[model samples]
Target: MSDWEEDWDNGDSKATSKPYNKRNNAKDNSISNRSDESGRHRSSENRAPIRYPQAGEKRSNGQRHKHSEKIEVPSDLVGMLIGRGGANIQRIQNDYNVRVDLDKESGTATINGNTEQNVKDAYNDIEHHLNNGPGSRYNSKDGSSGHQSNAIYNFQLKGRNNKPGDTDDIEMDPSGVIDWEALNKKAKKERAARWSKLPELRKDFYNEDPEVANLTPREVARLREENNNITVSRVFQQENVSENIPNPVWKFEQCFSAYPDLLEEIYKQDFRKPSPIQSQAWPILLKGEDMIGIAQTGTGKTLAFLLPAMIHTEYQLTPRSQRKGPNVLVLAPTRELALQIEKEVNKYSFRGMKAVCVYGGGNRREQISVVKGGVEIIICTPGRLNDLIEAEVIDVTSITYLILDEADRMLDMGFEPQIRKVLLDIRPDRQTVMTSATWPPGVRRLAQSYMSNPIQVCVGSLDLAATHTVKQVIEIMDDGDKFYKIREFVRNMGKDDKAIVFCGKKTRADDLSSDLTLEGYMCACIHGSREQSDREQAIADITSGHIKLLIATDVASRGLDIEDITHVINFDFPRNIEEYVHRVGRTGRAGRSGTSISFITREDWGVAKELISILEEADQEVPIDLRNMAERFKSMKDRRANESSKFNDRDGNSGSRGYRGGGGAGGRGRRDRY
Candidate 1:
């Protein structure tokens, strides 16, 4: 015999001397067939002795010899192979008559059997257990067990030529026939399983108020109708909801009766009824449940959260002397928003309920003194709050109510880390309320991580599109024509009609404001580069009607609630839809109609589609050129995305290899470190 045959014969003598177990032959034929189909047989000169059963293997009743092998198990599959109480592993050991050892930390499995086939069988069985376990099924087309035919068939089905009644046959390889029925059934099953996990309402257990729990379905429906069909949806909730949770009430009197002092204050402010957000949010928040309120700007969202927080604080009855610091904390994104919230707090600060607003660019010593003096509520920006916390001047442990107003804007302004730091100092069990004009992904992530089974209340569509209260007029023109067009629009407005001219940059706002002032238009500018005092003064001038026209950037886009502003002029269209929404929202406040005129240039083409959609949603007449530009922009975006994806795929493939062409060890040599 040749040397290779001699080696195979020598190895088989040891395997043949051992007794073969009958269970090892269960899948022997299938394995042999697969090996033959895959051309797994090596040349006779270099072949290793086969360990598994051959095409016609018989049981041997001779003395057995031990055989061993090691297999690596995926970390995620380790729990499944071990099973509960080691039941699956024990069963495998008993049935296979082999010893199996598993290293949990390293995720390695060692199998030992009296015969070679036994060890192979035990290893295969362990793999089978893992494959059938949870999260084992590969979903991507390139996955090990994923069927390329199924993916191709699905792609073909979605192709344009494969419509109903079309007799065009999908070409298939004869050697690899597609299983159409099986693929269809599997696709349907996966789709159904995915849809089964769609979001659904669950009972809320956070609020245990007996009054709120006693609410009936009939009463809830009546309240909803009275409040113009306000809806409350839950993204996530717990079971064991209190049966005493109160139903939503429409009017402020119906809800605020429990707080006579607050009710008197509301009456003093001439507020007859609650806004939609306030009406829906009061019941949930008053009952001590976390909430996310999404409403348009100037829709009374401040009062919606503040009122509940105040009522809850009153219920706690914590003495002013004993209170370590502010019992309620309201975090705003900007000094402007912080000041605005403080102004509203002052309106409702009846019967010794005091509030202090802290923000950056103000006197730190003054803010420290106010906070040290003890207040029931603290309204501040994130940066200033963090500064106070680090300085050990503010103790947030006593804070029970945490409110994040204009939350989406806060995240956009990159205040997430500061917000998180401030939250870390507060108690986790505090009732958290997040209010935003829009719900972006970042805002959603913050809500999910911080809030406890919060109820979401949306006043209108959550898209944050421009409200119908403002009429949008798109003026398509060249960059050179923008100034003249804005000037003409401003001149046409009545002298009493106040207008805000929005620019793309602070310098642009400054230059435009100067030009407008020189042209004899009463205009003043406010932007981030301006001092806080100057911004405040400019806002005051605009609010007091001393300045009929104001020029600014997106810094003034949020939480500047001036009444009857009449006009908002976009000298430069916003690059994003959210900024556009807030810019226009500056006007159309407190039941007053306003006009927004946007001067769109070539630079603003990217946002044309979204802007057009907002205009269409508001029922405004879209300009024909704007519609065409939006379509062209959409096509360009799609083309660019496709090109980018293709380029990435090419680079990824090239990166997998050591190098395409190189002389220095296949580009694997290390470079000198600096």
Candidate 2:
């Protein structure tokens, strides 16, 4: 039997079973503000946008209050302060019967009530809740704690101090703007301190937890190369099971019974066993429940959601007479992932359901025609979808099943506007599913707002990082030496093994590809800078095995799904550890063994050390020297933070001055590597 772990909510996939609702009663207080997060807040709305209000706006009351007297808060948090649909705010007003006026623009609040005690108590409660609560935090990692972060030791209200004769807290004027320079300086000091503590925080990854770290590099590589005792079955198995596990198989069998022919077609394709994500997700999605799938790449996530999407579409599929509606709409962060999804959907959507891939960069006219012709399943990136929506070329209301693949990346790439706009336009009764590699706080908030009691299915935690087929090696050297070593490695790779080289920038990818090609290594480069045609052609060449070596940025790092990828080379180390994982994940796919080598220069040691820590957490070996370099950076960063904090105490603005020793202005232009 294939090792399978089912998602809890999959047993009840019907959309009506779990209605999306807000937990908080107060509208303005709906968004929980964490104390440690400096003024950032989490909203209850399915979509949250950072809103900064202008000063001098009229208050809710007929009276206008001076702007400088009240504390300034981020606008997004204000909505939460008011109860659901403003009912909470009304209740507060009606209970105490206070004439409190909030001037959103100036961040000033005025209270006129029968009793000063009631008004003061209510206002203080609001302040206290925001300053210290699950919703508000000063230093919590997930921004869900009550304690103020260590970064703000002397944080104070904006209009706290006043001389008897000084006209400091005046009427709505340009004065009390929360001392932006001072706040920024304090934030910088705190961030530096937090980053410096990364080494200490890594204890969770290495503290005698076998699940966190198991094998050293030598043992893993030796075992992998020897093709020793370990078998695929041994590597993959369901360790923990209980009688309480839901009867999802029966539920799925019942829902999918009508489509015997489709089920036969699925099994005929030789996908005899469902992957972990697929096993759970397929049943739930087929039942039409909102879901949040947390699985890493290469865990068969595409098929997990696709199978159900296809099955659901087929069951409710309309004939060409009702072809104007879209049965399924899959939104991906990148064109590559979108296209990959379209391809997979097309394979399964064989019974009259048309699958279309729409994204920017290609010929829009042809794409427009494809969309207009009739497509049951549409896979697209937010940007192109928004363009088509704006042009009124496509109707999004007909979309029923919405899948946001790589959900975290969509948020990170700043697709909030487009995503919000699209979600607003879609039918409220649709089934939505979001999937991502990592679950951050922002992503969680998004899920809470958009998905209804989503079955949160996480295949493997950070402890079990990546699949075992990948061989990760980190080489530390000077910049020039690193490049030379890369050249040497490229020359030494087996001729039969295909390689993909990842760089941090388009220019670097192009430059390296040019240099490597001139040196007689067959290579093709792809990045955002290239035209749409060129990118597609480059990817086509790589997939066809026409190009043995492919160079790209993080663009091609996700969702390419080309089989037989033997090696992945990090010509330039990724800035973030998450990106590093995605880049390396391209190899060791389809049950094939692969090798990934990263060239870490002296300058990159800081980042490399974190990667090594992550690898160590995954039971991958880490070289000793790289660890030392990371420690050095941590120490340097700590000393700098301490010194900067002291300087800020004296000068009142250390952060804006920039890095420790360098003139603050000089550090702003450090993107010279590009």
Which numbered prediction scores highest in lDDT against the true structure?
1
Q: Which pairs of residues have clashing backbones in candidate 1?
A: 210-244, 212-244, 212-245, 212-246, 213-243, 213-244, 213-245, 214-244
- Residue-level lDDT for 251 in candidate 2: 26
- Cα lDDT of model 1 by residue, 271-354, tens digit: 767787887788788767788988889888998888877776666654556556677899987777889999998887665788
TM-score of 1: 0.64
lDDT of 1 at 345: 88
Which segments of candidate 2 are over 4 A away from where they belong?
Answer: 1-258, 317-320, 462-464, 649-674
For candidate 1, the clash count comes to 8
For residues 232-316, write the lDDT of model 2, one tens digit per residue. 1111122573211111231233334566666666766675455566645554565555777777787788877776676656555
lDDT of 2 at 126: 50
Evaluate all candidate structures by whole-model CA lDDT and list the values in order. 0.70, 0.61
After the best TM-score superposition of candidate 1, give how far the Cα of residue 666 lies from its true spot, in angstroms: 40
Q: Which RMSD values do the candidates have, in order?
A: 22.6, 17.7
- RMSD, candidate 1, Å: 22.6
